[model samples]
Target: MLASLITFFLIGLVALVVLGVVLAIVGAVFSAVLGLAGFVLFKVVPVVLLGYVIVRFLAPKEKRLAQMERKLLETD
Candidate 1:
């Protein structure tokens, strides 16, 4: 009866270890995903938007004026 109880305790301990390892792995994956999303939001998106603004400003004035004219006509 003592041996049976020891075996049961060992099984429970092993199961708890397995659960801890699984949770650690899942937490690491979740952290990595959140880090990647944050990098994209703070770094990539702003750089892309800045590049777009730069390109828009660098465009010819005639094209910009035409766009403004079209917008004015649309509003009218």
Candidate 2:
């Protein structure tokens, strides 16, 4: 009976250890995913938006300049 009790205790301890390891792994994965999401939100997204704004700001001026050049050439 004592042996059986000891065996049950060891099994419980092992189960607890396994559960702790699983939780640690899950926590690490969650942390890594959050870090990546934060990097994209803070770093990548702003750069892309800035590039988009710069392009939008320049495009209309470029089209106007192109139209003026065409008119000048046609007059010649």
Best candidate (score: TM-score): 2
Q: Which ten residues in a row have the lowest lDDT in candidate 1?
A: 55-64
lDDT of 2 by residue, 1-76 (tens): 9999999999999999999999999999999999999999999999999999998777888797898899999999
TM-score of each: 0.71, 0.75
RMSD, each candidate, Å?
A: 2.7, 6.8
Q: Please write out the lDDT profile of model 1 over residues 1-76, one tens digit for every residue.
A: 9999999999999999999999999999999999999999999999999999999899999999999999999998
Model 2: residues >4 Å from true position, as ranges? 61-76
Highest-lDDT candidate: 1
Q: What lDDT is reached at residue 47 by model 2?
A: 100
* lDDT, candidates in the order shown: 0.99, 0.96
